[model samples]
Target: MRVLFILILLANLGVYALGQGWLGMRPEDEGRDTRRFTQELNPGAVTLTPRPAP
Candidate 1:
């Protein structure tokens, strides 16, 4: 159906937009420290405080 095709096209476009950051998708490791840490981050760390806010 035409409606289904349009929906699928829109969904694909949304995925492309997200992948390209047009939808504001953030990298999970964007602000992570590039230097090696002596220990791994605890799973229970509050707000994922690895190094510091960028």
Candidate 2:
């Protein structure tokens, strides 16, 4: 049971480190425009909003 708890703790810590970009992992480059044209969402174009709430 103690070993299982330690493994879980280590796994959680690793995930947190990776998510926060720690432990020699390079931080994300913010200068790059990563947006793709194909992924654009146009809900206004497809669905018309009713003037009154239904």
Candidate 3:
């Protein structure tokens, strides 16, 4: 039972390490591209108009 507990503890630690990017695996490197959202086509063309009264 002690060995099983140790194994479980080690597994949890490994998962935590990977999640924290300590294992050289970054979240941004895994197909999470943010370029499209950051690069807007026209910044000056956007205008917010007030809603018409009912």
Candidate 4:
């Protein structure tokens, strides 16, 4: 039972790691993504400029 549990736990961990790492987002795509998706899904929307850092 313990071995089975460990195997299942390892498998779950592997899947979680794969998803968190492989499926993770690219840091470079953040800003453009919002505007890109917004315009694609909704027309006639004005895009706001990035806020200046405080």
- Top candidate by TM-score: 3
lDDT of 3 at 37: 75
Q: Could you tell which candidate, 2 or 4, scores higher by lDDT? A: 2
Regarding TM-score, does 3 or 4 come out ahead? 3
Per-residue lDDT of model 3, residues 1-54, tens digit only: 999999999999998888888998666567767577789899899999999999
For model 1 the local lDDT of residue 32 reads: 69
TM-score of each: 0.47, 0.44, 0.53, 0.42
Better of 2 and 4 by TM-score: 2
Window of ten residues with lowest summed lDDT in model 3 = 25-34
Pairs of colliding residues, candidate 2: none
Clashing residue pairs found in predicted model 1: none
Best by lDDT: 3
Off by over 4 Å in 2: 24-54
Candidate 4 local lDDT, 1-54, one digit each (tens): 999999999999878766665556544554565655555555558577899999
Instruction: Note the residue pairs that clash in candidate 3.
Output: none
How far is each candidate from the true structure, as Cα RMSD in Å?
11.8, 7.2, 3.4, 9.1
Model 4, global lDDT: 0.70
Sort by lDDT, best first: what order?
3, 1, 2, 4
